[model samples]
Target: MPFIVHVLGFATFAQGTSEFMLSGLLPALAADLDVSLSEAGLLVSAFAVGMVIGAPLLTLATLGLPRRAALVGFQAVFVAGHAAAALVPHFGFLLAMRAVTGMAYAGFWALASVTAVSLVSADRRGKAMSVVVAGLSLSMILGVPAGTLLAQHADWRAAFWAVAATTALSATAVLLALPAGRDTTAARPGLRTELRSLAVPRLWRAYATTALTISATSAVFSYLGALLEDVTGIPERLVPVVLGLYGAGALAGLIVGGRTGDRAPFGVLLTGMGTVAVVAAALAPTAEIPAVVIPLVVLLAAGGFATNPAVNARVFGILGETRTLGGAMNIAAFNVGIAVAPWVSGLAIDAGPGPAGIGWVGAAFALAALANTLLDRHLTHRHRRTTSRSAPTAVDGARATTVSLYAGHDRPL
Candidate 1:
């Protein structure tokens, strides 16, 4: 509810726009730069690689800085990267620029989560974090579509220039809005500490759940446009509209997920993953039916995104004060899943399979995640019970004695 949240939202919007706008402009980039589509695709791949490296590295390096300052610095880097991309004529130069952008983007992305949590009481943390992340959904819904339109009407360079301008504006806004203070007490846990924490069975289970969920969703979403055309008989021009619907569904899910996360994170996660699996499977066979296709696509979008806030909350809660690093690591896990899913789905598609293969793959991933979630719940419950039973009773006895002394009347009420 703070004005700073708006600034963070806008910064996230700019980051998301820059990250996705390239997809729409890929053809223009390929034609103008005399490169293949594959080469153009490297722009995306390069960004992912940067994210894979940048998330943890930047979080670690900037561990001591104020969140506001870190965010501002990252946004500045993002603006510079986009500016370079707009001006660079060479494909290799553009790729490098995009990679730099990804690095900057990762820092901002991770910081945003930490900032959101730090700004609010523990009770509102999930909703606060969700509001910032909702910027991502907004980007998919509004930014990507608008950027694509800009590229179509003007040159693709226009899109990058627009994003650069947006990034600059967002950077200025964030710098002006967020309070200036450092959190020196927050953990400076090096990679060794982080690794040890991650080695915990419960944490690994969380990672597996996150990975599976992302793989399931990305496997289908990566090729959704093509799938719609082949299976749903949607025209190329209408694919964007359908995708927009999907984004809308995701936006709705984000809001709902945030509100529900506080009371029932695990429940939200379980229901969301289960719903995603069921919807994906159902949609597989009915892809030719427009009515079914449209609703199912929406369901898939909702189910996939609805789990995000809950997952983030759970992971951060598990890591406590070390959330920034943990959040970034979880983000890296999501990206890893994104990288793997498409390849897995592409192989199936290439083998003369239909879009249905995507559903099967997604379902399998969801089931794996579900299994992990159940195992995690069991372990957590067991741990709680064991701790309750094994904790020294003297501590409780001392508390009782202290209470009796304070009451003075000393008759056991």
Candidate 2:
């Protein structure tokens, strides 16, 4: 990986910390603002909503800007939001600040994705992505936990201020480290032409697959702490330990998936999805068995995260000149997964399956993702076969033009 890739990952660590740190600070925030716990919880939801909308919208807004400048600009917004949130006493003001910070984070995600993919050669895109994914995983393991500790020792506002300071430093690193230019890997056509690239069904399928697989994982993950406490019978302090182990699996799986996903995208998808499905389904029946459930938690996180690099790499592979927009779309899809899955999991809990229901429900979603992957592979192979069978006819005038287009002289993303 390039040095700049690591810088991008480091920046991600700073921004991603704020993404999940709200969970740890919710109780304090509620008491400080004199609001209901449920109302304070909306602050997290506001961020998710910002992420979902900001990805595509902000990506497009900065479509024509220099990559480094856009990243720094987003970082500025992120820092400002955090600083404002830290000072603001009102719940509504803090909520708005959280949303603005989320938008900044999502925009940076979109730009950083395209930038990362562009930095590496085609074959190593997945490995490069793993570096960035490590930032996110590490945020779970290190950053959020650290923020929580800060909130414990000091104040929740201290945590917010910490994120602001870290984010500013990250932006400075980006300004110094990354080059001041747009992505040269893809041509910048007019806005309409760029939009046209997204019409490809293959790209949409890739995005849908991303959303579904992640949603499957989150359905289980969102309630994992509760399940560990209620069903697994683990001590309260040990719950974080198990969760930390799960976080370690994400970092560990980065190496496993990063090394292999470049050559075997489908293999990673199948194995990862299959592992998650099996582990999740088994968790329901074995919830009381600590020996089984503990390992399963680690496996679930590893299996789910292992697919992330491959998914991003596949998106870039399928994209045409609209790599920026496609990256944004996929980022939007990711936030969709994060936002929607918890709600689905909550439904399972409400319907009387209790915390154990998340496992089976997640299993079902994983299977659906697996099936989608199989079907996508089938269609892709069929298309390749059909195209090869008619390569001879591609030499004839109109056919030649169409063949050229299909082979990417002027293709869809």
Candidate 3:
């Protein structure tokens, strides 16, 4: 199970590195392609749009398939997309290939979460999920910076080729590590039934919280390189190193965040969100102070990345029998935020580099996330109270054949 988890993590590591490395290489890509930076920025946006569109739809379409086959197939698609990106000469074709890559990313991310849960016993589910999510965090910490270094020394094409190679390696690892005929059909639920789960107020609140949190993080992160250059006057050669440091903070936060989630996910989330708000506000005024800037950036990255596992765990916990679909939707919410943030922040940057303006943008989004978190907590508390008050009478009237609400649903192992 640990080996299987590691293999899945490697695949996500490759995917995430490819997706985010674009930000660091935007200037190189524009220079090579003879396009404006804005045009190159579209490549990032295109991938996010693909994820937002593909996650839930593809998950639903491939429902009931063997998990191993689905995993392999999606990764194969990703390899093909990277191959296209590596070989394609035209800018238009490259953008199109990125969209295809995004679709594969959505499939992989959704399936990876569901598969991670299935691989573990009920008591180990949280650990399993964290191990998988840590892959993404590691990519941010290591893979993106490594890819950026590769792009710096070689051509941008080298980075894409490296991504393809990593995907192939990860695909091979997964094939060898996981057992044959591992079934996911038993975990499948009806689409309508899964959709109905979203109608629960608590569920929407969770989704809203996830969306706002992601939007808040991405609003700043999508432009982090630019922010470093423009605000802190960091040398271009140093941006990757700084970004790597940010990724390091994120990796550290992911580890600490998982342990924190086990104690109290909601409490952790509120605290993280509040911390982000304060960090963003502080960042706005301290860009010139490296002592202040570095720590603030670390805090912002740590707080934002830390919230991910807890939020995911909370949503899946509420999902009961529809954990797979629910997990996919949460991922969808995240990608939607990614898609929206760059375009919005890009507009802000294009308007003028006020430097501190980006921090304010980040701050505003964090405030919104804090609001949503509080709202979710309130609603969840009220729902629990109402359920406790009515439980006995409802139990007396229930049919004998009624399914256990939590039965067969993947829970923390």
Candidate 4:
């Protein structure tokens, strides 16, 4: 409940706006740069690529830096990237700057995710995560739309200029607010030790689940406009209204997940993924019915995103002591989903089923995520029983230790 945590969210909101604003400006950007739509589309992929690479790379690069310095420095780079992007006359330069902005966003997110926890008690980690994560959802609901309006009313470069200015303001706020402190003392373990911690099978399982859970919605979301137009037969003017409905569902899910995830991580995961699986599979069948498909899409967003906080909290709990690499790796996994989901869905559409195919593809991903969650629980219980076999009394102690783990008894939550 510290002020710094909310400040962290404020900073996230600014960066998130920059991250998603590009989608709305693509047409204008393409025309202005004298490029094709597909060529301009590469900017989104460029950002995703940078995020996937930068999460761990920058975490290692700034391994021992203080939290405040790292955050402010990252924001400075993000601002510079956006500013440079706005000023550049050529498409290549803009693409490179977008990638640079993504890298800065990734590094900032990697540090800030754990930093939010450093200021809170174990019991409140979920609340902290919720506050931090809510910024991204809010950006989709609010900032992206505003940026799109700006681009329509002015120019695409104006949107980029606005991003740079807001990012600079948030960086200034972060510099003024976040106290100076080591990013992570536990990370004092050298690079080799930190890297080795990531080899754990359990961690990779968590990473896989994170990627799958995220991909569930991201795939469908990428093709939503097309599906709404070609399949649902919705008018172009009403598309934003439907998108707003989806964003509302996403924000609502994030809030619910953040509030309940700490006490019932598995339950949250199951319910959320189950909802996504159901809605995703139903989307194609219901596409011809607006009333049916619209609500389903909203539920799809809600269900897919509800698992986010829980999965993130689980990763933090599992790697409580050696979190140096976990946060970065989890972040990398998120970008992996973001970058790959749309591509996979696009392929499915191109292959045969058309826009409706995105539904089945998304459902497959959601079901896989659900299966992974179940497997994670089974493996955890089995591991606990195996570890408790030393002595009868050790069983109680081991159970308590795991209970503590779930309660975030360890510091790196």
Q: Model-by-model lDDT, in order?
A: 0.73, 0.78, 0.76, 0.78
**Tens digits of lDDT, candidate 2, 1-413:** 78888999999989988876664566567678998544665676677778889998998898788788889999999999989888876888988887888888999998888888777787777788889878888876877667756766788889889999999999999988876653453355556866877887877878888988887777776667567767789865566567667778888877898887766777788899999899999999998889999899889889999988878777777774357787888888887877777667667777887878889888988998899888777776666556656665545645744543333212222
Worst 10 residues of 1 by lDDT: 404-413
User: Candidate 4: how large is its RMSD?
Assistant: 3.4
Colliding residue pairs in candidate 2: none
Between prediction 1 and prediction 2, the one with superior lDDT is 2
Ranking by TM-score: 3, 4, 2, 1
The clash count for each model shown is: 0, 0, 5, 0
Per TM-score, the best of the predicted structures is 3
Q: TM-scores of the models, in the given order?
A: 0.85, 0.87, 0.91, 0.89
Those runs of model 1 whose alpha carbons end farther than 4 Å from true positions after fitting are 21-45, 89-95, 179-199, 354-356, 394-413
> Mind sharing the TM-score for model 4?
0.89
Task: Please provide, for model 1 over 322-377, each residue's C-alpha lDDT reduced to its tens digit, 9 standing for 90 to 100.
Answer: 56678788777766676566667666666666665787778778887788877776
Cα RMSD of all models vs. native, in order, equals 6.3, 4.1, 3.5, 3.4
Q: How does model 2 fare in lDDT?
A: 0.78
Worst 10 residues of 2 by lDDT: 404-413
Question: What would the per-residue lDDT of candidate 4 be over residues 246-340, giving only the tens digit for each residue?
Answer: 77788899989998777778788889999998899999778878999889978988887788888888788776656756788888898888778
Runs off by more than 4 Å, candidate 2: 22-44, 89-94, 179-187, 230-233, 393-413
